[model samples]
Target chain A: MYYRALGFQKDYAWASHDDIPFSPPKIPLSQATVALVTTAVVDASIPKPVREANSYPIVDVPDHFDTSELSWDKETTHTKDRESYFPINDLRARELRQEFKALAPRFHFVPTEYSQRHTIETDAPLITRHCLEDAVDLAILIPL
Target chain B: MTARTLEAAGIATVVIGSALDILRTAGTPRVIFNDLPLGNPVGKPFDRDMQHRTVSAAFELLFSAEAPGAVKTLPHQWSTQDAWRENFMAVRAEDAATLEALGRATQATRLENKAKGLFRR
Candidate 1:
């Protein structure tokens, strides 16, 4: 409704808020350990999140991941022998070149269709702990 | 989901995706809006060089951003037209009823999976 008031159509997802948390990075880019997080349902092996209530993880590189369930055209996703929606190879190449100090021990996968409540309460803490455990300093979120 | 939480826990993040409005509303600490296809956020599939640049630019935000919720627009061009509109139209042109049904079914599947404890290891 708020988005519609701003001339956006009914299809737009709009949320009104007053205050949210904000914290700047404490380290430089070259010294940081980067991690990849995506919501494109990387592999069918990943347990799907609950409707508006949860998130899950896909361990290791999904060599056989499928990307057809997402809204994107399959032609683009399947081109050039691509499998997973997460860019593991690209991130790895950057890491190998020392673009960053290191790569996180593991990557993460979270389904995009969920409520803010679930994200803030469950998904957030899980990801934070994982990042902290792996000593990751930066996270790259690739939403579908 | 994870972006804000990571930032709050002292880790920085850069959301590289097409939905600038959604990311801002979600309070993403750092955002790099890439006007690319939905599934191809990093770059066009198999284009390693472009993908590396996209990831590099995303990481650059860690130091360049002055405040929380800093959003920068990337200059890469992955799609020729409006990405979301294109996806929506692509599905609609196929079958309107099927698209609507599939949307509902996806939500239902989530609830089903949640009940099965599939959201955890």
Candidate 2:
């Protein structure tokens, strides 16, 4: 099912095709500071996007919703219609912190945001400013 | 700031993205290969072993990459996503509430879209 979606019919050689770019030099993982932020609509302050302009943002359970296995919930059924706000839900945050602890001990968790492919310069400086405060040397973003 | 801005500021950034097509079209420079899934690139949540492999592979590509357009895809038995659905069956009711809430919020949705229009950060 997954293979069909990526349209991977070009050439199996792509797997062996090792060609990438360089910027954050391949220094020892420690020498380089790292951060991880996922696009799961997770936010520490507000509820995971379950309200609408005319709705009360009710907190209800969805048909297939699950919450006990981990610290946060990635799938939310309360959202009005998959809004434009960053879906920084509790579940995503939990998973993010887990990855941070695993991959990069010093990895910082920057505030969540929407579409990494689109965030504006002025809008992100505020978030980046705090990341700088946290002593973050670099960022490792995972878009969900 | 974009990779260009970060480089200009002397703060180096490594964009481990799956959108190679978009990156190529836009002519984004100094990027690396990481065909990890869109959100969970390093494989499914809690899969530590795979995560390590993905991160290690990314570093290799980053270090050995020849030129700006240099690219590399990991040789591990990579597969498409969708396994998460079965795992998600164990989610709790409270967590379900959270997902529901996040799915609906209208104002927040608008705000997110607005941010997208501003920058592809």
Supply DockQ values for each candidate. Answer: 0.42, 0.13
Compare the candidates by TM-score and give the number of the best one.
Answer: 1
Clashes of 1: 1
Question: Model 2: residues >4 Å from true position, as ranges?
Answer: A1-29, A44-118, A131-135, B30-37, B66-70, B76-121
| Weakest 10 consecutive residues of candidate 2 chain B by summed lDDT | B1-10
Residue A50's C-alpha lDDT in candidate 1?
A: 40
Query: Once model 2 is optimally superposed onto the true structure by TM-score, how far is the C-alpha of residue A26 displaced, in angstroms?
Result: 9.7
lDDT of 2 by residue, B1-121 (tens): 2433333343445455555665555344444444443334444344455556556555455456555555555443334554534443344545665544543563466578656562222
Candidate 1 whole-model C-alpha lDDT, 0 to 1 = 0.64
In DockQ, how does model 2 score against the reference complex?
0.13
lDDT digits (tens) for residues A27-137 of candidate 1: 776787877776654446544444222233324565644455555645444433342246777667667787778777777766554355566676668777877888888
User: When superposed on Cα atoms, how far off is each prediction in RMSD?
Assistant: 5.3, 13.1
